[model samples]
Target: MQAWRVHRNGEPGEVMRFEETGRPVPGEGQVLLRVRAANVNFPDALLCRGQYQVRPPLPFTPGVEICGETPDGRRVLATAALPDGGFAEYAVADASALLPAPASLDDAEAAALHIGYQTGWFGLHRRARLQEGETLLVHAAAGGVGSAAVQLGKAAGATVIGVVSGPGKARTAAALGCDLVVDRRTEDIVTAVKDLTGGRGADVVYDPVGGDAYAKSVKCVAFEGRIVIVGFASGVVPAPALNHALVKNYSVLGLHWGLYAAKDPAAVLACHDELSRLVAKGVVEPLVSERVALSGAADAVQRVADGATTGRIAVLPAGAGAAR
Candidate 1:
């Protein structure tokens, strides 16, 4: 099988190489999948840099989520068991982790749905308890995970304020159902959000970018508001001032969606059901901005790592042309 592998810890473009490799054999409790489309996630770049939580031994494949086909011709979404990841033509996934691909989405879109959307669903509904008619603020609102939050927040009837880095992403966020879009590069996030919300501030803050973004959220968060920390996409992990949170009477919640898949699989399934319904209704659509062939997987991952992509990018590995 043809696959891309990282032989050393480095930037994805610097270390990832394509080569013919032996097909990965699945062991007990696992299923083998013929990769159809694999989404290039930021973690792929972190894995390449040896910066992610779980680093595979040297010479590993990095794709985490994929839409795959079984030998029986069933289409499913699966998490690539590291080392034998979805970057290849074939990969192994735990049978328990496989989900039926939503009929409404294409392979690339299905591949994008699992991680980003799941994170947003869990962060907004399960953690922050975002309420209908309330204002929700999303950071990095044009990126993969942030865009998912925008869609879900709107679907739940919340007025979403999306904070993006540029005009292009602000347009994308508006198209994704954000009631208001704030360009962070030129406008002040806290001020814009406050002005949009009539000075009450956001009732719920969905922060995927930590550094300055998190700090700014603190300034504009409403009283008794809940701030859900999804990730540190800004590459700086900021320590929250717990005293300020206490004095302000707001809550800060940390969300790691993967833990639900292990600790409470039922909750994960429930979230999937809701996401699937939204997909079927066309209420939530994964924004796949670019689709690259397997040959360009490494570069796409690098683009995501460099924060240069506004939406999802999927690698088509089955000889199908990548869609725009």
Candidate 2:
């Protein structure tokens, strides 16, 4: 099998090298998946640079999720711990980590599922408990997780307001069913949400971009609302203001989807099943923007790190073609 490996912590373009390796054999309770597609994630870059929360030992592959088929022919989306080798053509995964992929989605879309949608679903349904007809705000609204949040928020019956950086992203967000799109570069999120919500504020804020967005999200949250902190994509983590939380009576919830997947596999499977139903009903669709060859994995990862891609980018395994 040809796999992309990183021997040391550095930029992915400089560190990731494609090489032939022995095919892996699944141990007891594990399955050897013929990887059809794997999605590039922000953490893939961090893992390459040894900057992510979990660090693998030297010389490892760094894909966290994948969509593939088990040896017995079951199609599934699988999430793995650090040292995730989904960048390879075939990788070994524990059977417990596998969730059946919806038959309605193709391989690229299935690969795109485990991370973004799962994170969005957990944030909106579990953490925020977003109520029907409540106003929801999503930051970075064209990126993988952001776009997913927009779609899922609508499916959950929330009126979504998306915040993006430019016009193109605004259109992309709108296409995902956001009720309104705010260009953060020129508009004030607090004021926009206030106007859209009739001077009240957003009932739930799904923020993956921290830093300035976090502070502003606090300002726009309705009284007794919930703000779900999903990620720090803006490159900075914001400190929570307890005083503001107290005065507004809003709750700040941290959503770590990976932890939930690790601690409770059953819950993860249940969420996947729900997402599958949404996909079947066309209520949620995976936005796969790019499909690249396995050898182009480094470039794909770089595109995600540079913030040049709108939706998910999936890498086809060695000999695998684009998903039909």
RMSD of each: 1.5, 1.4
Tens-digit lDDT track for model 2 on 34-124? 8888888888988998888889887888777788878788888887543647898887788877888877788889888788999999999
Which candidate comes out best when scored by TM-score?
A: 1
lDDT of 1 by residue, 184-288 (tens): 889988888888888999999999889999999999999999999988877899998899998999999999888898999889888888999999888999999
Task: State the TM-score for model 2.
Answer: 0.96
TM-score of 1: 0.97
At residue 14, candidate 1 shows an lDDT of 97
Query: What is the lDDT of every predicted structure here?
Result: 0.90, 0.87
Count of backbone clashes, every candidate in sequence: 0, 0
Q: Candidate 1 overall Cα lDDT vs. reference? A: 0.90
TM-score of each: 0.97, 0.96
Error of 1 at 290 (Å): 0.9
